[model samples]
Target: MPRFTSRPLAAAVLAGILTPAIIAPHAAAVDYGMDPDVVQNPADTPNRPETSGSGPSMLTQGSSDGTVTEGLINDYRPQTVNPMFPEGRDHLPTADIDMDPEVLARLAEYAKVDGDRIRQINAYSPSMGRTIPLVWIVPQDLSEPRPIVYALGGGDGGQGRDNWITRSDMVDFYSEKNIHVILPMLGAYSYYSDWLEENPDQGGKQMWETFLTHELPGPLEAELGADGTRSLIGMSMSGTTALLYATHQPGFYDSVASLSGCGDTNSWLGRRGVASTIYNGNGTPEMMWGAPNSDYSRYQDAVINAGRLAEQPNLYVYAASGLPGDLDFLGPNAPADDGAWDDRRGPGFYIEAASNLCAHRLKQATDARGIDTVYYDFATTGTHSWDAWNNALREFWPIQARGFGIDGGSVTPGLDGEEAPWVGSSDSSRYTDLFGPSSEIYGGSTAPALSSRLDDPSLSSQSSVPDGSSDSSGSSGSSGSSD
Candidate 1:
């Protein structure tokens, strides 16, 4: 595992250098029109500054000034008691019953699709005292239990019950292979983690990690015929969450795939980007993990914890440079011939470029640890949009199918000949290239010890081959609401 040996930097640097770029007021209308199915028009929903803001702080004036005062900074300090969890509950709690039948019945009304049978499970979360909507797509055949493919939607704050059916052909693809699909309706900017406090923007307790990993499986297995084995694939914000979850809970997923995700949450730039994203979504950073450079932030840093991912049986990491490609104009949301690319295509491209840089950092960490199961696909040209993600999902399906022990029919061409792109070594120089030599980003010239255990030659020699059995299960449960 890679390491960071330098002393932590002052929080003032983050406030001084990072906040301005993140919170600058918007000059134009924020576009949620990229995926109408996943995001509603900002005009359709009333502007609620108390909860979900109008738009990104940098893009809207009414949003909160993205500043962290000294008092709020202190809140990041470790608390004597975690407010989100129940008192005296040191471990994860379990669900006592299956999903409420009434909720399922309500969801059943919308499950009538052409090809596959879609069902809704009102997964109960003890931490939040509410049930989260989980949409499942089960194949028509009931011959046996099927391995599950957990697909997470990007940050859009709307109910994503129809994302798989509407956004892409995931339903048809998975159904044909007899694989079950689970799409949790995570609110737009949840980031899918156990927050330090209840989110003001999205409301409800943000205990997504607990729910996705611990609570939802039993009901899925018992009621939905889902075998214990699973693969997790997420794009954009959820992409980052997927990687973090996999790292935090090793062996929890047979395979993990990240599409255009920012994985390096500990770096100065990375931290600022995520802080901006949270604040723009009308969420407070202190509520999610704490102040910048907090211990909880470090704990949630996927790059810092990439060593755990090295132990996974399979991994797929992808990102595109912020440049237009031949395929960019082929999707439903293709750029218009007009100059809308200046606003629509340009910003997403750069965001994805930064995310790709983070993915590069993850690649360096995984490479340094000598993990060989990783399949990294870095394109030279592309933008951050659903089309790219949809294509990535289709391209990576065969690899995911193999990991889940399913034979995905008719392998997509050019997949076998694809080479994992290399992004230099995991060294101080590489860090400089990505974020410059400023102490604000690098902290020091040397990398700190991310995980000493990963450096052990004996441990590195152990096979990361996952147990192909479908009986394994993990534990916890929690819930949250969308903005």
Candidate 2:
């Protein structure tokens, strides 16, 4: 990952008046249209007091005849808890079941013969603390190691774990497809980043990037027989993390699918944004990047990274959004026709702005690289919410399944070689290419570790290779996500 060099906090391009960022299917639907003027200078000024007389603190204004009238005031309070943040994963009570031991036994027994069932597994993140609150459902019928699909809530409207998966149709979909499903407990505001600056100890508790790419996989391999056949499919923020993970750690996952994911970290924070207070004081893009306007390093806009991964043909990409009415949480009660503005109580408030730009740039970049790309533009009336994501997920599954070398017909190579694996960055400064080397953390493992472990067939022999035959890009996979 190249360090961010600029600091004029990249402003979010809004959809329209009274609307949030949005990526609708229709060309006339106005996926996202922002007034460039809305962007602000990050260094302009800190939140200074602009006071008027109206009682003790309220900002009031003197009318034409010196009459005092209460007027709008600008008092920026620190955002301690993000509304988009899930309630709490700190000490989330685990199910009474002993998941790890049971899963290992099941894997040992199943390795002999082909079988499938309610395969229970655990997922961990160092920042999420010691307890393993995450559980997965793997179908029994898969012959080889299937693609891993990670689902969660947090970005835009999909935050909080309690209702995130249950509220939608994903659990059923996973069961139907037999795709290895990873369900993490990301509530609304947790961007799933290892927040180094937010902790009092600066312990990097939020270092989920390390856990997912390293710690969690070992257990999955021990239990469910995961041999690098992985894919992350999620909504909103988790969706963005899916792409960032693919970009930062190439060769880890064969494909990445994002439904209504954000394009840049700065989009979440308004212009002149605060790092710690809003993102839980875990070091804003500036702090994470070690300079001003450094959001790119953390979130890693897909537009920039995809170009770097151009050679990696196995890197499949998919993005989609729902029609207008389909996006409403409660159907008609939530109207889809809100212009791009901050109508907090209204539907499509925040997600609209971010996902629109993200999907657009992601598609543009992938398409330019001649990477096999799939973009579904559903039409109807909807907003930026789970309902929309659910719809989008259903539409996206076919593409995702194909990426796993499942849905698509046997992928025969063309006479001309398909895309090759992306090599590390040519620029020494930006060494963290999609599958390149990087600094280590949390005792994380590298692609080399995965390769070395492949020598033994402790897992299924079929699990060694990714699905059907494919080309190798010789890329080294690592871990990371935008805070």
Candidate 3:
């Protein structure tokens, strides 16, 4: 056998392929720009507009103050108030679909030790041509279909699965109640919307709204033992997504809950914060909904669409101040040490404060529209961490169970659960004013009469987008309504 030398073989192959004549610069160059057809025009691309620079800078225009001005608040007053959910509309998905087998195989890798009861599956989306990872938890005794709870994660992205299992007792709670909990791992910094443009770094078309609302439900109901009835609960970033989804698709969810959620995205500070978040997450605001002042941004805003949220049968919104509460120091969920507390305090403080401001803004919009379907909880002492969210989840379970039309009495540990050790004590007194009779923090008592145009049966099943509309580049006559 002949002895083979690796270096000499590689050198011979490279030397043969890469000659000096080929590598040398050519004196003559061809100008492809001269041929119009040779170079594809950037403007001709679908839904993509090529601009000179990165459109606009949100940093210069963003507000540092957490609160919106009185003028800005007044600007949102509606010229014509419309009913959110018209009667006789088909709220459920009409199509029958199945998950791709290859996608299912990929999702099976996320399964934990208890693979049968708890398995992570990738839900396929035809619109996006990709699969999103989702952790599914079902009770072993599944003789019949169970009501579904769609739990969305916050800014940290898809951590809701881990959080629901470890940071909170939701697994035990849902297991005992025989409920189906779906936790979607939507990746970090995804605001859970259909992005205006594809993210180059993330490398996928994020059609989250279409996936959740139109695609996932049909398969879930047929194969995953899920009933038609559903509820939505989200924290932080997803809190806003949950609110938008419930409002955008009327009658889809029986109840909706937001924990430490930012609800106002149209305000100067709100828009700024959203822009900043997108930028930090390796994305651009232009890719999300166009410029800060574009119609896409306005339509997606929860505060701008408060009238839609008011139509839901039940709504729960909760937020907290950055201040350390009694539970922060004393509960089983409390920080392990001072260093842990300190580590969480900085971001937690700002996020909680911002969420409080957003909650107030959302309340203002709902109250102005005479929408009264919200249960508000503005804790006086807490942060944006999981501890506050876990507490809110425990407290909101009764309301969630009621929305599912099931007897809430069967929920584990009752209201006396160890998750909330300070439920009835003075330690919880700080949030009393929010739920009191004279609470100005909630919405109005009466709903306004619906306009004829809004009550038209023909328009009930119509899509959220208006007729004769185009993309979000402001080229169309009018920006269509978001569904």
Candidate 4:
């Protein structure tokens, strides 16, 4: 994924906003237009400070006559946590229960650091009529209401295991940021969408849309101290779902980030992506959304429903062109790449290339309609793996910090250094014409490894295609409702 910046000239744009930087569907203002960055606005400033104050540093006299007023001062600092954020994950359809063995083993890896802050929370989603396991991360310092950042993994949605966390440093990084993070252990193979029908093979009615937007947040926010703000981020397969979720509900998530995620899923390539994701999960499209180009299937497309995002002028839209960047091969935090079909590096090249194509289409669609809130991180060079995504989380955080009331100043800007993935320079339109719009595989520098892997006919025939489709430029698909 590219660094989080403007759709084009991302570095220069961020340099301007660091120099600076969501939609709402469900309605009423969530943040009340409160500026969360600065502790105080300081309406007035003097060239120099007086050596001596009137009394114990309580002076607010800027009048020409110099009269001091003590009793009229009101500090806007948070006295207690936001009524929404402090509640913890609230009343549930089911009580918190023991985590699955696999999940527990995963949690064991982080026990030494802040494992105690994480608790296993099992909540029932009546929409799906099943138990959804969630990893609830309560911030260590609850002095103020914190924004809840809901992160979803791509491809099989982690197959019931925490996907990206196990592959990248996401869990560790967010753990120290004092944000309440919720990772749901559901939607394996599904796109985390509310399907029309359950797959007969990998069958289970999935109301992920309702479960996440309606059922899950209410009780969690009520009891967990939500601060009336949320940020939903997704990668790979779930990336499309994340973008769709923002359009699904207005004013719900103030911030939305799609790292190397596709926002257009109505094209032939898009349909294939959905199909392949289901196939890997051992399901079929007939059960999920019926035939391709069906009326119901179009409703699930992100670009088709993007106009809904324009309703939210303040929405933070972040996406990336899945080209190779500094973090891919040399990433210090990513798991080792063995160059196998399943390894993060090898297939990631083409998969991310596909996502890169999908991203450009969405960028044009959003731009054509004047949807300017988008921050498209078009990496000049990245793979479609955890390494790119982990960097994206850190990069997107600072931009979101000010709005979410966290001090964005604490998050450092990623420079040209290899370690800094958030480097400002970004553009989303890199490969829209590379080897024709129909081609999804383009090797920037990561081509060698992919070529070597594909050289072996045995491995080449056995490798599971990443998106299972080309990241082509055909924007035509079934019509959808943006509302």
Candidate 5:
């Protein structure tokens, strides 16, 4: 037999040269052990969480004022908002998306969704100047509109091969939950930022920040039955993206989270990660954010924006210690000389180590500002893998749920172990007072009406008129609108 027969055999099988009868015997002999039912669901694993530390799961740090919590958490035992469902009712996936038929007609489908759980929809992004793929975990059973939780993928924007869906069980996990989970396969290595110029390697103009915050939401929300509230959760590469997006567009996301991501893009390690992630994908930092140490660079750093994040009411930040955990494939059972450890596991350890530092820095920055909305965790043992990320998600859904305007989805510790009581829509974080009516931004389902700050006794009497002066509050506030 030739040295490599797998490819030829696979090709022959696809070409119909090898019928089922010819392949069945060989296939049956091979115990790939990949049955979805038998194989452990990443969403369901790490169940035996035995943290010896007595500290809170929510990263709490001492501040001049008092205690401070770190990024994303689930403290919901807040007994107010109506639950989206009964304790046990599971909502079936349904939708009334009103995307433009012509535009929808233009986008080509990359791959069909799986398990009747996820729906793959394509859209032409005006910002990217190309079609984009969106995996929408539509809310289970629609009545009143629900919030949208944008779960972004990690790694260089992924070419349909590497992503949350492909590498993790989070898709099925979120699908079963109530909130709408929209994962846009975007900005592979650009940090999901608006690039000054396009990198030919990146294909074209990468106006992701604008695309997500301004362009996509306008039309996408218009067609959907979404509540005005939206949240973002991202891992690794996009983790920083989520932080910056929520930071820059304050009052846009009800809650935001970053898992195993660096917050200080201006820091030496943070910049190194950014440069490597971008360049590895055949991109350059100049095209993405301009020259190093530029004002624009500082503006992009989440640490520098901590004060802005401080204003955010709900946030979650998490990173593992980088030591191998139960889910790491190259753990104790794998041979040391296999080269897999050096290639993957080794890099994972250091990557997570770097992330741990970033997470601490973010906590420090937010803490210094007296932020109290974070639910953070710095795992004692975990790798830069989905097992850990899923753990974070299971734990953080409460924050997301709180912001979504409802409650009930969260992982609770039990005598046996930890389990997700519910994962779908009872979604929302505590609604922060956002400016402007959502209608002006999302032509789709409108979010809650904006609360006028002018109503507050704190404001001094001023002309609600546009005095050709630099002050914008007077003019915009009077219109029941905002910038």
Candidate 6:
């Protein structure tokens, strides 16, 4: 009967005095909904796709030479043989590890009932000065060593142990299809790039490239019992890094995936505003690249450099956004506070580099290439959170699976059902070479709450959400990826 004027005080008093027997279970936090309707597994999607709007239209703009650059056309880049590895990485050692009992047990405990096998191990990168911890996931039944798909983490770098191997939507997708997955843990702040400056005795100048491309493959090959031919998939920051590595060393990866990882170091350092953080607080973009404002300065913009990503045989590229229209959380109004420019507010603001201008240029370059690239724009609603990425993992796995010569039908709802829009593949306006025999773009009436997990700027992590809630919408129709 006493006045309960203060909420916090009342909560504390009740919590302290109330025992389990006295307090009732709170129903406010519980969400009760009808059982979800299950559809056919997406991997089993039928091929009878609805075709609309002229089949596979060419996005090619004219060049003076008059050769059509649309469709499957031959493209090339002047290969620069790393003088360091002239004979190739034949000298690199083979990776061998007996899985620790603890890691093995955990892997088995969380073993996806869907027949996914997960392995946790470490690879030392002498160039990067640390042991690159990795988690490898394979389907339980596959005897033959399959092509590896390398997935890079987004934060300062995450421990690959329990990160996603045991529980990622993408890995699950691949595992179900029998594709091998390798997740590596680079230094958190490293952004998978070689430090321009040295870190102790480790190699510095883009040494990650050497470790990933030249050094680790031998051991990985030996461990997997196959030659180290693999694919590259990156999310957010790693996404850009994956593309850079693939473009620099074209033949290593058969396919490339960039999930919410558009733009480059310029975008991260310049527009994303982490330049000084990347350079160890000793350098700014202006100092590192001569003049920050100069377009021709050192370290050319990655988006602009994308034009050079031409010419990889059997190259499959995929770029996607959880939400379109400048990512909502990015750009000038990101933090909405002056304190956002804490470290060095110099020329390396990555947010600036990730601008509409940057986004437009990147789209243009990718589109110019006649590669089979797919730019999925889930612009209706969502954020740059892991939940959105998880859904992307669903959509992306199907797309990537398709690239691996694995064919299937639509797994999610809407695209295959009666209300579906243009099916059987078309080019997104954002990119050129990205194509599919069929594609679905949709929008969600409600953005999933999972995106908020990555809402924290201090700890660059993404959130998780339920599947099929995030929507992808172009101007025409909306679709969901529940499968």
User: lDDT tens digits, residues 248-328, model 3?
Assistant: 775788888887677566555555566545543456556776654355655666765666765776577776656667666
Per-residue lDDT of model 5, residues 190-233, tens digit only: 67778877766545788777667766775677666677888888
For candidate 4, what is the lDDT? Answer: 0.47
Clash count (model 3, backbone only): 0
Candidate 6 lDDT for residue 410: 46
* Candidate 6, 36-97: lDDT as tens digits: 12211111113322322211121111111121221221111122344345576666553333
TM-score of each: 0.70, 0.51, 0.65, 0.63, 0.61, 0.52
Best by lDDT: 1
Arranged by TM-score, best first? 1, 3, 4, 5, 6, 2
Off by over 4 Å in 2: 1-129, 140-146, 156-164, 186-188, 198-204, 266-283, 286-290, 293-299, 311-323, 326-350, 366-381, 408-483
What is the C-alpha lDDT profile of model 1 across 170-265, one tens digit per residue?
767877778888776534566878888886445468887777777766656677677777899877777788778777776778888887777666
Instruction: Summarize candidate 2's per-residue lDDT along 155-220 as a digit string, tens digits.
Output: 322211123343455556776666667654322233455443443322224555556665566565
Model 2 is weakest, by summed lDDT over 10 consecutive residues, at: 1-10
TM-score of candidate 3 to 2 decimals: 0.65
- Local accuracy by lDDT, each model: 0.53, 0.36, 0.51, 0.47, 0.48, 0.36
Better of 1 and 6 by TM-score: 1
Each candidate structure's count of clashing pairs: 14, 43, 0, 30, 29, 41
**Prediction 1 TM-score vs. true:** 0.70
Query: With candidate 4 superimposed using the best TM-score fit, by how many Å does residue 194's alpha carbon deviate from the native?
Result: 0.3
Candidate 4 lDDT over residue span 44-72, tens digit each: 11232233322112212211111111121
**Cα lDDT over the full model 6:** 0.36
lDDT of 5: 0.48
Please tell me which model should have the higher TM-score, number 3 or number 4: 3
Model 3 residue pairs with clashes: none
N/CA/C clash count, model 4: 30
Q: Tell me how candidate 1 scores on lDDT.
A: 0.53
Worst 10 residues of 1 by lDDT: 12-21
